[model samples]
Target: MFIIPAVDIKNGKCVQLVQGIPGTEQVVIENPEIVAKDWENKGASILHVINLDGAFGNKSKNLEVVEKILDTVSIPVQLGGGIRTVQDAMDLLDIGVEKVILGTMAVENPETVEELSNKYGSNRILVALDSKDSKVVIKGWMEKTEKNASELGVSLQKKGAGGILFTNVDVEGMMSGFDMDPLLELLNAVDIPVIYSGGVTSLMDIENLSKTKTFGVVIGSALYKGKIDFIDALKYQKIL
Candidate 1:
């Protein structure tokens, strides 16, 4: 499985949020460009970049930082948060993001995802299904939806989403280890590539997740907290 390092940007700084809460954020690095370059040098295949400001409704707040990271890293960056329109996705793609991850838009405006997939091809479009108790959440995990994650996974795939980033919001940034049952269920429900996120605390968690058919796993708080060493974890995954 691919080991992707997450660089979540809030207020133009690289931060990690606990359970998607704003004030619960912990700044990991002052310069996101430096962090992106370091991760690239350490053998990260792809970097996961999220804009917390965008997720909270302030969409344009982090574009400058996002641009810096893109300019600094040679590796692909899969960006998420606040990408609500096809024009928004296109603008990012035009600026060199390898993939754009859609969560709220995927749930609220699947037609936009379809339009993007058709224009850019599905490989460049990823739909994020953030959930709690297997029900998908949107608007940065602040709003709960009646949609089941597994069902949504299949629906997004049908809409031409190249892949699914399945994040369990309950465990996100908790450093508490993952709940495998729900992850496994979502994996089983989707035929396309599925990237697992949330609650990865140790190399053991990666080892266990590797047993599943996930395309990749996003490591956030665990990496920032030193619970898991990025380079070492990549080596353990045989990704380096």
Candidate 2:
């Protein structure tokens, strides 16, 4: 599995939010591109970015930050949050982002997911299924839905989604290690690549996740808070 570092942007700074709560955020860096370049230099093949400000509204708040990162790194970047329309996805791709992740759009407008996947090709479109207690959450994990992550993953796969960014909302930003049981179950439920996110804490978790068939792993608070070393974790996962 690929060990991808996360850079969540809010108000142009890198921040980590506990359980997706806005009030529980802590800034990790003053300049996100500096951190993105550091991760890229450390051998990150892909970077995971989330626009926290955009997720809460329909605005794209972190475009400039994202553009800075794109200018700094050669590695592929997959971005999500506040991307609700086709033009939003197209604009990001036009700016050299490798993939655009659709979260709320996938749950709220399933047809748009299918349309974008078909028009842009599945490879450039990712469906983010963020869930808590088996219910998919939208609007930046602030609203719960009746759809379960697994069911949504399967549906997105059928709709031609390239992959699923499956995040466990209950464990996100907690540094308690990933809730792997649900991820494993999700892996069995869908044939598409599933990128595991939330609660990654140590090298052991990376080692364990590497043994699974998931496409990749997204590390946020664990990497930023010094709970784990990216180099050592990648070494343990046999990536470097």
Candidate 3:
């Protein structure tokens, strides 16, 4: 399994939210370009980025920040949030994002997902399914939908999504380790690669997940707040 460090951008700054709550955010650093470069230098193979503002309603508010990171890091970066159209995906890819994650658009406009998959291929398209209590949330986890993560995962595969980024919102940023049940269910339910995110707190968490078939792990607050160290995490996963 690959260890992917997360860089969530809000207001053009590196920040992390507890349990996906907006008010619970804290700025980790002012310059994410430096942070992304540091993570790459520390041995990260892939960088996962999220636009919190875009997830909420502001679109591409942090594309500049993403651009800066791309300029600084040699590793590939996968981005998600407010990517609602084919043009949006195209623009991000053209701008150097290795992959574009479709979250809200996957649920609300699967046709766009198909178009993007056809245009960019599945390898460049990832569907992010953020869930709580089995129900998928959209518009930045602010709105809960009737669609469950498993069901969404299946639909995205049919629509040609390259991979699934399964995040358990209840455990997100809680540092309690990923909610494995949902991850397992989605992994079993989908044929595509599933990248697990949320609640990764220790080397044990990484070890436990390493035993699974997860394509990668995106760890944020735990690593940022010193609950987990990046180098130790890479070592635990044998990536170091």
Candidate 4:
């Protein structure tokens, strides 16, 4: 599995929040494009970029930074956050985003998923199945739903999403280990590619995750905080 680095932009800066909470900025840096290039230099094969401001409904100029990041790096980038409309997803993909992730849009306007899939091919679309308290949450993890991750994964896969981005919000950004059973269940529930993110603290976490069937894992605070070396993640990805 690929150990993709996350570049979450909030209020025009690269910030990693704890559990997707607004005030808990663990790693904040200026110029996200530089961070993107740095991650690629450290041997990341792909990047997971999120617009936190967009996710929370603020109209920030983060897209300009995203454009700069696209201009800065050659590796494929998959982005999520505030991509609510079909035009929004198309604009990002037309501008060079390899994949556009859908959250609330996937649940509320599922037909759009099929529309995008038919228009751009399924491989360009990823539906996020982020869970909190074992229930799926959207709109920056503030809006909760009764549906669980695996249930929604099956639904979205049928909608023609090329992949599933499963973020276990219960353990996200805490640097604590996570249980793999729920993840395994989601993996068993869907035939599409799955990308996981959350509490990954050490090389052991990487090794353990590499043993799973996920296509990749998105590491943010742990990588930015230097808990796990990016080069080491790449090594384990190769060997496993």
Candidate 5:
């Protein structure tokens, strides 16, 4: 499985949010391109970039920063946040994003998922199912929906999504380890690649995740805080 490092951009700086919260964001790196290149140099095959501003409803602020990161790294980058419209997805891809991750858009307008997948090929589209207590959350994880995550994974797969980025919000950024029950449910529910996010604490977490059928895992706080070494974790996952 791929060990993807997360580069969450907020206010034009690389930061990580606690449980995806706004005020709790801590800037880990002053320059996103530097962090992106460092990860690529350290053996990251893909980088997961998130626009915290866009996610919170200010979509236009981070495009320039994202552009610099893309220009700085040769490795593939999958971006999420504020990608609510087909135009938004296309604009990112047009600039160089390897894949566009849709969250609220998937829940609010699944037809756009189908349209983008058809136009860009399924490989270029990913649907993020961010959930709390197994029910899907959207609009920056502030609103909860009745839809179950596993069910949403299946639905997105049927709609031609290339993969699912399943994040369990309850343990996210806690450095406590992953919640495997809900993750496994989503894994079983979909045939497409499922990349897990949220609480990842140590190499043991990656080891446990590797035993499953997940496509990959996105590590943010753990990696930034040095609880887990990126290269060591990659070696354990046998990705490097």
Candidate 6:
């Protein structure tokens, strides 16, 4: 499993927010390309790049920064946030994004996942299943859906999605620790690999997560605020 680092971009700057809020940024830094490169240099095999402007229905022209990030990092980059349609996902893949993550689009237009997967191959498509209180949330977690998380996972898997990016919205950015029960439910429900996010606080969490069937864990606030060491996490992932 890969211990991926998040390089979330908002207004052309690299920032990490509390539960993905607009103004509650916990960490902000300039030159997202440098941040992406730093993570690559440190040991990240893949990077999670997000376009907050696109996800939140804002207009920040984040694609410029995303392009810079893609040009800066050699490691495979999996990008998400604000991908609204199949063409957008396809265009990014054409431009060299290793994988394109779809959240709102995947849920609203399930057939698009099948189209993208069929065209780009399933390995190039990832569907985000952001969950809150066991229900799926879309559009940057601002809106909630009546859909159950695991049930959606099964549906997306059936739609030929390559993997799932399961973010527990309830605990995201809290820096406490994630509950394993919910994660296990999704893992048992779907056959595709899942990369978990939210509430990843320490090395113990990393070790425990590494032992599970999770594809990888996306470390955001905890890793950014120094609650957990990225290199140490990488070492643990390799050792296990």
Please, what are the lDDT tens digits per residue for candidate 5 over residues 125-209? 9999998977999999999999999888888898999999999899888888877999998888889999999899988899999
The candidate with the higher lDDT, 4 or 6, is 4
lDDT of 6: 0.90
User: Count of backbone clashes for each model?
Assistant: 0, 0, 0, 0, 0, 0
Q: How many residue pairs in model 5 have overlapping backbones?
A: 0
Tens-place lDDT per residue, model 6, 16-36, is 988888899889999999999
lDDT of 2 by residue, 124-235 (tens): 8899999898899888887889978888888888888999999998888887776688888889999988898988888888888888887899999988888889888777
Candidate 3 segments exceeding 4 Å error? 236-240
The sequence of per-residue lDDT tens digits that candidate 1 reaches over residues 126-228 is: 9999989778999878789998889888888999999999998989988888789888888888888889999999999998888888889999989888999
**Whole-model alpha-carbon lDDT for candidate 4:** 0.91
Model 5 accuracy (lDDT, Cα): 0.91
Clash pairs, candidate 3, are none
CA shift of 218, model 4, Å: 0.4
Clashing pairs in 2: none
Model 1 misses residue 93 by how many Å? 0.8
Give candidate 6's TM-score: 0.97
Candidate 6 Cα outliers beyond 4 Å, as residue runs: 238-240
lDDT of 4 by residue, 1-240 (tens): 888999999988999998999999988999999999999888888889999998998634589989999999999999989888999899999999999999999988899999999999999999999999899998889999999999999998999999999999999999898888889999999999999898988889888888879889899998889898888788877423
Per-model C-alpha RMSD: 1.4, 1.6, 1.7, 1.3, 1.2, 1.4
lDDT of each: 0.90, 0.87, 0.87, 0.91, 0.91, 0.90
How does residue 192 of candidate 1 score in lDDT? Answer: 88
Number of clashing residue pairs, candidate 1: 0
Candidate 4: where is the Cα deviation over 4 Å? 238-240
